[model samples]
Target: MHAEPACETSLSTPPSARWPVVPLQPAVREAAPRQPATRCSTCSLRAVCMPADLTSTELQQLDTVVLTTRNVHRGETLFRAHDAFQSLYAVRTGSFKTVVMHRDGREQVTGFQIPGEPLGLDGVCSGTHSCDAIALEDSTVCIMPFGQLETFCRESRRMQRHLYQLMSGEIVRESSLVMLLGTMTAEQRLAAFLLDLAARFQARGYSGAQFNLKMSREEIGCFLGMKLETVSRMFSRFQREGLVEPNGKQIRIVDLEGLARV
Candidate 1:
């Protein structure tokens, strides 16, 4: 989520006058791929992904549990449904969408995950993944081996509490989605979805008013239990009413109060 600062070197001076040129050397072979950083204590997302109030010693111990990271490309499945689940993944960068396929072959998007979110919780109880987690963009995830995590959790009360909270959060999210699907209108569902995204982004140190949609309208519709056309219409209506402004996949909430009232 950190943006590379723009290089702002002045070009007023000629290159020859600004610095001395060195003679070219023999060309070297391509370097090996760089490994991602695995230290949780130094990670920018530790606050969001790890348990709070963890001492330096605790963080170092936790780092031992998360020993590696895996990169998943856009549109690629991180893990398919029914895969034997061995580890939980914490999003280090980018986002993902979890999908469940019906017997009729229709795919339903269950949830969208941003950076710092956890995936693979669906398999905690059954020991087999119940859905597919697909990367929405080229992303990296810290792999926490569940066995080691469980052992560590037993030793650290804080970690055990945090693990329980994560499971509770998953239950609450699913229940809320059920309520939305069963009791809410399409407009209300979409409004709540947008508001929820805004709040999540704000919690992650991003702007609440403006952000790009990582999931497509069709994906959103699937998650919201609405048709693609209905999802598009809702966005158009929100724009027309001056509650939001949409340009392609980008959205800006122009009137937070108005959107809340929807």
Candidate 2:
């Protein structure tokens, strides 16, 4: 699920002031030429992506339909707000965050994406994207053209069902995030956030109790609706209380139940 700000809010600014800053890096290099779709069936994320319910012959057909693979550098914008929606992307590596730039010029983080996650669903409703998808680190993605997907779904009952599931999950995730922002205390929110990340990692067959925090502390605070200092203080408190062992970006859950109690 992605977390969006309650409103046009910035941790450091007056309510009316806009958040200032953008990735200052130069444009990313162009992506490599398109590769064969055979890569899709063999992708580790096959279960989470296109090949989930496809037979060998179906997978072969899929290879012809996936548009291309793309490489994105850290700080690069994959697609900007209002960009025409053409495809949905599955993260093949690294991570990304979707952001919505406010009319006042502030930016609100909408969601963080990891491997196996599909992005660009927001465009389904409006035809144009509602936010910018930016890479949090060097990443690669498999592009599935939405038009092709729709046609395929019409022909494959399993694929159609899976597409419905993805859409339904996205809606549920957004609702839960809204609740998290409205009713939870800061500590409770942070605790739940960590638990959710752990659960997601475990689902992907990674260690659930320990992992690296790919996003920066400030970014975490921004997403959590807290100041950077507040995020730091909470992490320190968690460590002192023996709930977690955080060393820089590395975090190990020492007491998962204790954290849940927070």
Candidate 3:
């Protein structure tokens, strides 16, 4: 059996004069809705997302705070660096990548968010988004307006604790990434990355051993601190060693222990 990760992991933002906000184009605003938006109590992702201990009335309160779902298309920018931040986004479907531009003009992949994941926490401390969140595919996110969320959190200890846990998890995940890049060999890093993804998918009730890669090899390499060529070579090596089987962007872990050993 594969070791489970504590929670989903990822890969933030900048400080400056807040950028002039541009309204999302009408066409972009209306991507075909995947499903009719539902209340928080009825949301399928509530188990992994909201506090598990909330009472029925508290769940109803949360539902009122969430305004609606917003659809983001492949390659669309959900929020850009320096944009004034007001809401936190919960991934209702698909995935997103958070990236920051370096002073040297290169972009760094900060994190990848799957379903049930939240983005825009970077803004809490600064009041402006420090990174850009871009959708990897057609996706939808529930909008949790921070002001309302903060009010609700104050009245419920469980919800407050859950919010702290999410923030704390983000901090720990970042520290782990630093350690991962600082100490681990390329192979170990790749193995850990795949295993992390597997655990997250399994948590979402998907097959942990098999899944599609929403982020490309280039993006994965950027996030994992390796070259694209190196990422590809590692994939080939893992395939040859029977650690995993790759068909295009889809991968299956044939030997979970073998991967864990790396």
Candidate 4:
């Protein structure tokens, strides 16, 4: 059964730090416009809404508007590093990888974006983005104006809580990545990555143990701090051990328990 939207949280995120609502602005209508045909590049009701829930009137307004759709080709920037953090993006269709370059010009991939996932959210202060978000395939995104959304969030107690909840999870994910890349062996890292992806997909309503990998072995290696050759070898090693049946992009965790053991 689909879950009822969680009650919005009331948090102490200081509204003074960001955009505050003003009287000069036109009063937001009770019924607003919504984009027709919520496409993959367009967010549906679940993923984007997590940072907050919409009132019935707001939903009606949203459902009436037409959202802009833009295609970002593979390896192209959706937004560059240090760009003005003006918008929050939702992966409507396709996938994205966020990367940051080191002082020495090495690229470190920060995270991957899947459908229904929100991005560019961690940027708020200083109005500058810290990383480059790139499309892995031809991708589409829902560009939500950050200032307006934050203004709405300030008024809605629930929305504020949701935003923090989302941010907190991102922090946890990044911290865990640090531990994984810092110490785990190649085999262990690969297994952990798969398991992590499985659980995440499951939460989003897909079969947890079975899914196609949108990232190539090389990209996975980049994220994991391993070489492309090391990633390939680990995959072969896992397959030989009967822990997974990887057929091209298709990967089935034949022995999830076994993989986790590594």
Candidate 5:
């Protein structure tokens, strides 16, 4: 799932310049609607994205400081390949995918972004995007400018550690994907993918180990480096074996551990 990432500008501006000095124009100063952040403090998924030691005031500041965008339609390009990286994007809802294309006009799905996942960190150090980021469905992402993000991280050592952990998590996922593509059989690859996705959904505070698949089997085949028929057959066989229940776009993991070992 590749998303065209949001463009990020260089953070060369002086510290004082982080917040624009443009006076609030009368038109731009309308009473902004009150939209409070969901009570993440009580959510099970908070383990993945909780701000360490952040106060209620800090939470409000983070929300206010960010330029959150919404209503991005499915199949939309979030950012094109090689776009400049100036901000960190955190997905608030829906799904996204990142891809790398080949000289042969083929595409390889690199990573899938779920809610709370950041997709553009691959180029954070270099200040340029290396892949395309596209939304899989209507989505929302909060854009945090790099300079402010840096300052925030510097001020909060825990946040800096969390950022490193996020990057490290990305590295681990990529390494696993590499191994899955390099040595696993198509059937095994398919099993691993299903299991991984099931685990992901469960991590998102969902029940029945069930959710919808935004990607087609053909896209799954492309990422798995197998034929479309192979992907279909694997799914069919898994369903027949009571490993998964597939009803069009909706899916349920009936025998969770059984499917994991498939």
Candidate 6:
């Protein structure tokens, strides 16, 4: 047979030598949402919530202990009655209302909390929460683990004294509420409430003369121990008397002294 026409067989060429190898890039991934870390050293409410005299070292320690923060949506309960207490929460934003439910299903509003206030003190005594702490608006809180806080308190005499002061303040608040309910008239009670709010807001560097009311009239009545109708009437009367200007939830204290006199 005539020499098989020299067939060029390229099968002997290695595949790797024939083609350029390209490295594959890692598959792209979507980033997850980030959780905000608590930084007490730079917090605006540090002056209000934390002690003024804390050294930089103490503040850094606080930041480590208050590493976690929680968001509580409007009308959601932060802690229900009888829940095991592990942390004390400091209000970082918005407000809360503490409520207690009776066997008959009646809800009693105990107190309202604004920014820079502390919660879960009641749990300290019994190791469980005594009432439901519901958010009045979308809110955030710095969670201080109680065990860590206790250890810190033991180390820092200033922090320990501050904790004792906070407890004493709670007792005073309860006593004041009892006095308001027992001795004051409805109008006086309302006046005292407004003035108290003014002072608190003022302390927080807000406009004390005018502010929005987060609590509803019905909730206000529940707290003030008055009927809803009575609370509405009182608000109307205050408006007519030019003591306060109430346009829905917005309140402008037209005559601070006059309201105080009531």
Clashes of each: 0, 1, 5, 14, 16, 0
Kindly list the per-residue Cα lDDT of model 1 for residues 81-174, writing each as its tens digit.
7677788899999999998765556676879999899999987986777778999999988888899999999989999999999999998998
Off by over 4 Å in 4: 1-54, 61-67
Clashing pairs in 3: 11-110, 11-111, 13-130, 13-131, 14-130
lDDT of 5 by residue, 55-100 (tens): 6665554554454444456897666555666666777788888876
Lowest summed lDDT window (length 10), candidate 4:
2-11
* Higher-scoring candidate on lDDT, 4 or 6: 6
Q: Over 4 Å off in model 2, which ranges?
A: 1-38
Query: Candidate 3 vs candidate 4: which has greater lDDT?
Result: 3
Put down candidate 6 lDDT per residue, 1-262, tens digits, no spaces.
1111011111123323422223333222232232565699999998998899999888888888888788888998888776777789899889999976655556768799999999999889867777789999998888888999999999888789889988999999877876776677778888999999999999999999999899998888778777787788889999999999998898999999999999
Q: What's the TM for model 4?
A: 0.77
Best by lDDT: 3
Better model by TM-score: candidate 3 vs candidate 4: 3
Candidate 1 ranges with C-alpha deviation above 4 Å? 1-36
Every candidate's lDDT: 0.81, 0.78, 0.82, 0.67, 0.67, 0.80
| Superposition error at 15 for model 1 (Å) | 66
- The residue-by-residue lDDT of candidate 4 on 33-133, one tens digit each, is 22434632234434544434567655444433324445677887877655656677777678899876545566667688887678886567556666788
Candidate 5 regions exceeding 4 Å error are 1-47, 56-61
Query: For every candidate structure, what is the RMSD over all alpha carbons to the true structure, in angstroms?
Result: 17.4, 5.6, 6.8, 11.2, 10.1, 26.2
Better of 2 and 5 by lDDT: 2
- As for model 2, its CA RMSD to the true structure in angstroms is 5.6
Q: Please write out the lDDT profile of model 3 over residues 155-224, one tens digit for every residue.
A: 9999999999999999898888877766777888889999999999999889999999999998888788
Task: Give the Å error, residue 70, model 6.
Answer: 0.5
Ranking by lDDT: 3, 1, 6, 2, 4, 5
